[model samples]
Target: MLKDLAIIDYEFRQILLAVTIDIEHFAKIQLLDKLEQRGEDGYSIVSSFLESNDRCNKDGSVSNYVKTEIDRGKSGCYTNDLVARYPSYDYPVWEFMELIPFGTFNQFVQFVAGKYSDKKLRNSFYRLQSVKSLRNACGHNNCILDDMKSGRPSYQVSYDVKNALRAAGFSETTLKTKMSNERLQQISTALYLHHSSASDGVVAAKGDQLRYIVKRMYRNIEYYEKNDVVKSSFSFFKQVIDAWYFNDD
Candidate 1:
């Protein structure tokens, strides 16, 4: 599981950094940019990509021009392919929201888009499907992704992350830079621990599983700030996880 996680953490970061730095300017994206810009602690890059338009350039690169010759060989992202697969005609991002698991892909986008998409979020949804899978691998203490896991990521997993990043128009440098941050590593481990604990170490559950993860986030904050729990920050079952703990607020 750890191996799966290593691959996923690197990959998810790839998607986030790609969206924030390289993607074209759009209203939805701007708010997400601000989160990263202001908080200095939030994962807003991923947030922005989730909210904004997902169209690619005719050249299939986010930057108006390709800077490296190697970039010419990149494949079309699953986002475009998903748009191509379902809702056959040209459309926007919201059309396929229902098809996406968990519905948060669309909900999060709508939260930022301020309007629903005219197309579908399936492409983004597929990428997230990869995120959850990778998340499980790491949470279980199994393999490591870039660290060279026992089971290497399938082409599907690799392409999902890569394509999501590409769809957001990010460069390899930007993706790698953000992904290597110690802060993100800490965040990923903590989230993994919390999510895994939520299901009593069962990471196999699907989308409904987010509530446990979200619930744990609030609990972490509460235990840290309110309780002043001066432990090693290592409580696997730190507290009860409840979505209402966050959503009701």
Candidate 2:
């Protein structure tokens, strides 16, 4: 189970990073389109938002990040005899997303509603926040089960996720059961993001990796059972994994 956890953590991080990066790209596209439509200057408008005092911490997070970058440059972040470097984004796509507070994504979605017809953007923002939480947990190497139980998942299992689970041979009822458990919520979130953001081949490979790890874990169940905490967490995940791997319907 310990070894399985390391694998889970590693795989989970990969999923989170991929999803977050995609979201970063998505936000950049939206911002650029909005700016273009408004006939606004990009750098000036964005800089104003960042520098504004009325903008709350969440709204001005990206500004703070820019400030940090400036500070790093002043401090000579990477000064050498032949080279000098500082954190900078040529296009600022991903870095801009990272700087924005998670909550701002939702507002941005609403802000752009008139520009786009798809209502799915709101759902995407909701899921993005959930993905952020999952990313934080995985990035920090926190106990996944505990994080899920303590935190609220950003979005419930949507049709995209449902379709993925269906393709994996899980029925609606089974998917519901799998998602209802807070301990298994991260798995659903991971699979959802993987389905939405990754290519078909990549998603398939991720699914296979997840199944393989669970199978190995099942074989070593007794080893995990020796510890009460491991036993409990493993049991929670085992039900969800087994359902995904060996769907009867």
**Which model scores highest in TM-score?**
2
For all candidates, the clash counts are 17, 0
| Tens-place lDDT digits, model 2, residues 1-249 | 557656665665564555555544555566567556767554444444445423346555434544443344444434221123313332232334444455554444544453455466656665556666666665676656433323343446566655766766666665665566554665565545654555556555555656665565466667656566555445544554455434333
RMSD of every candidate to native, in Å, equals 16.9, 7.3
Model 1 lDDT per residue over 1-249, tens place:
334334444543443232221111231244345334445233343334343435467888553111121122234364445544533222233333322333244345444333333132434334334444444443444433233212222323334343444444556654354334333332333333333323422333322344443333344343345332222121211221221112332
**Top lDDT hit:** 2
Please give the lDDT score for candidate 2.
0.52
Report every candidate's CA lDDT: 0.34, 0.52
Error of 2 at 10 (Å): 6.9
List residue ranges in candidate 1 displaced over 4 A.
1-89, 95-231, 240-249
TM-score, per-candidate, Cα-based: 0.22, 0.54
Q: In model 2, which residue pairs have backbone atoms overlapping below 3 Å?
A: none
In model 2, where is the ten-residue run with the lowest total lDDT?
81-90
